[model samples]
Target: MSRTSTESVTPTPAVARRHRLPGKALLGLFLAGFVSILTECLPAGLLPEMSRTLDTSVSLTGQTVTLYALATALGAIPLARATNKMPRKHVLQLALGVVAVTNTLTALSDDYLLTLVIRFVAGLGTGLIWPLLGGYAARLAPAGRQGRAIAIALAGTPIGLALGIPVGTWLSGLGGWQLAFHASAVATIATMAWAMATLPNLPGRPAEARFTISQALVIPGLRTILFALAAYMVAHNILYTYITDFLSHAGMAGQTGWVLFAFGVTSVLSVLVVGTHIDRHLRKLAVGSTAVFAASVLVLALFTNAPVLVYVAVAAWGFAFGSSPSLFIGAAINATGDAADVAQSVTITVFSASIAVGGLTGGLLISGLGTASITWAALALLIAAAATVIGGRKHAFPRNS
Candidate 1:
């Protein structure tokens, strides 16, 4: 994946001249991503209620998230490949349909094992959704503005974390844990319909144009980007997965929604900032986001005695993390050029796997070392991730990007 590989995929000047974002299609993708993430993390904010209702320990309940990520990681590459020749719009609609159905079933399930199965299927839906979104946004974007288009499209992740989870927590308080899932199902269904009407029905990859997972993996800078993505996502999830428990431990049990809301507000700001600067300063944004995240965790590790400090740290964390998917997937695409879709599938696989690792790691840390240790652990991982991003400047996150 040389610079020439990147240049090869750049839109011609004529195409660039007319390039403008397909706002309706991108918004449809945004909502699809929003629903997918909202479904995935809804349980985080309602863990205790879900645990009690399911007759399982909180740790075991957390595996719902882990299992979902594991399913996504396991399925992304194969599913993306399988659907390569299908209509892109149809593939998205199908995936969104599965998400809606599975989330509804999850809301109805009384048996923990049954709920796990439902969530697993939902994860498969998201596996497809994640890989498609970046490429889909790129396809719909005008020539030079693909970065901004992708930023808008992927904004749903942070929004889901920032607003969706907190809102779900509030709704669970008014109704029950199941209400969040029901809401997610309704939202997903609506998004699917919006996509059908608004999104372009692009043709899928022709056989000769398709690239394999192995081929995507072998791209020079791709593995570095994946490694950094894994580190960043795992660290984020360690804290994110068990956020409610961590808050309770820190004596902010009643402030979970508020805290997350604050995080969400800044996360939106992050998207705005990244969208503005990503195309010209991709390397700087990558380094800066990782470094900022590490610093935020360090604050979390050392300053929980003050609630204001905690809020500030968390807001910073959200700002740092909000644009990560956009940054990483963008980097991967730049690296893999014409194989951008395949690269996206591989990136999503690593991203999902990291979530699983983070959830499992967070659970273990809570059981063994306790919640306080999670921040420290996350801090260390962020440090390593930042180092990788900083050192890989020659390729992975090239300064020129």
Candidate 2:
């Protein structure tokens, strides 16, 4: 899985010569990425309503988020490996179908346990969708355009985070939290149909060897990125999973949607900035964004009562955190080269696990200590992540393109 091997496969000669770049297909992938993330993060906005309606504690309700992430983490590698030889279009369609069905079930279910079960099923779909989409985006990209293609495809995530969660929260306010899930199901169904109609048959290349998780771990650069990514995600999720609650506690309960919306907007802006330069300046972008993120968390921790400061902090947090997945995934792809799918699978697994860890940790902290404690704990992790990035600067971020 050397860089040469990876570069050679990114836009295989057959792929580049046989087909023009499929703009609509990439759009479908983008939508798939969008819907997948929307499904995963919808719970964050609805945690309070869910807790009350389900007759569960807030911490317990937060576990719904934890459950989804854990399921995704647990399932990502096996599913990625199992479907490695299949056509990506079919795999994507099936995964989106799973998302649609499970979310629909979640919308209709009244039982907390049942909803959790359905959410976990939806996680399986997301776990499959991410790596497949990453690889698919790379495959469809013209030679030397893989980074831009990935940036375009991954734009779905920030959109979902920026627009979807806040909008869902607003909709939940108008109707109920179930409305969010129902809306997600509808969106996912439409995206699945669009993908089915639009995505070209992307047959698996049998000549390309499949790389295992063990193989990916053996690469020091990939390992370092994964470690930093884990810490970063854990820190971010700790604050993120309970943001609505944090706002509510600060007497700004009615403003959660607007605050989150502001966060999302800056996130999109930051990701766009990263997209333009990520291919050439991966390490600098990663380290700088992370440093900004830590500083934002520190602001939130220290100034919990200042409305102006809070808004500014949230925007800063959104900008840095929103740009993260693309930069980190790009790092992984760069590290693994030809073994991009394996690297993606591992990245998703670590990402999911860290989300679960963060969510659970926040829940425990909120239950026992306090909400402000989450930011402090998160800040510590972010500092560690920054350290990892600086320490591994030379070896971890070699130019892949």
Candidate 3:
């Protein structure tokens, strides 16, 4: 949990007060965060190949994803609370190291249960380190630039989401599923090395800022927005959880690989475009793009049975969900002010919780109502997100909090 050298090697009290991160170092921080996210999701993209090797059915192979999500959801709060005082540099290194070691273990394991355990551990590492990394990114920025800095760091999430799956899929297709973890292990290791050499000491600690659960919970306008985000995410996760499954069942199996490829390509593009925009115009962007998300979901729900629309829906949904990281983090930062880290962790937890809920919701919706139900629920949630964004904007104040 070591911090960057800014705090540890200040020339004087005044200089210490003025210290900030270098440009390359800041970029390195964003890369580190992105790499960690990629490592966290590596197992998910390779689940099918992993299933064949683990001798388990794909449904059970899916447990690794659901449970990894659950673990991250449960682990976020305490990890944020406990590590607030730890050195920023050490925390990052530890997180990256956890990814590296567990990925190696996953690559080496033959047992499915053991592999599941490894994924859980890797998720835990993500929960423990990610909040701090996000908080520190904002802290590392100059006073007015927190929004821009956070947007850059958040871009990592999409980078991870977009790259990890494709890379894992390609590697697994070329060799075995194990190659995915090998690549993850190598990526995280390199990230760890770079983080050790870079990453600045964060200047603030949101967990300790007010030091009260109630206070953190009562962050300005947090409840409505958090729940809105959580709800949308849950719905999104449910739809996404069984995307490949549904496509296969719907006779789009032949195009599944292309769908994923298109989704990845579009996701990266959305992140690049929207992440920065969210930073500068939080309210406008949040309100404007929300319908885009809803429309994307609704269209997919109706047209998923069509080959062309199926591809379009997947790519569009990718764009919609891909823009979330920056918006959510920005909302939290706006709400929490000095408590940006804790707030960010809460968003992560909410996000992770949504994934877990999404899986359950998707499964039940698909089973009880039908696969089409998934889109309706997802669209409903996205509408809620839009409402929340609109509502928050209406009531928003200069509460730099």
For model 3 the TM-score comes to 0.87
Q: Is candidate 2 or candidate 3 better by TM-score?
A: 2
Better of 1 and 3 by lDDT: 1
**C-alpha lDDT score of every prediction, in listed order:** 0.88, 0.82, 0.72
Error of 3 at 134 (Å): 2.6
Give lDDT tens digits, candidate 2, residues 1-401: 12212444476778666545567888898899999988888877787888888888766776777788888899999998888888988899899999999988887877789888988999998989888877788778765556656776787887776775676678799899989988999999999888889888788746458776787788768889998999999998788878877897777888887898889889888867876766667788888878999999999888888988999999998888876888788788877777778899999899889988987888889999988789899999999999888777655765433
The 10-residue segment with the lowest total lDDT in model 2 = 1-10
What are the runs in model 1 whose C-alpha is more than 4 Å off?
Answer: 1-17
In terms of lDDT, the best-performing candidate is 1
The TM-score of candidate 2 is 0.89
Ranking by lDDT: 1, 2, 3
At residue 122, candidate 1 shows an lDDT of 93
Model 3: lDDT to the true structure: 0.72
TM, every model:
0.93, 0.89, 0.87
lDDT of 3 by residue, 344-372 (tens): 77888888888778888888887898877
Question: Alpha carbon lDDT of residue 186, candidate 3?
Answer: 88
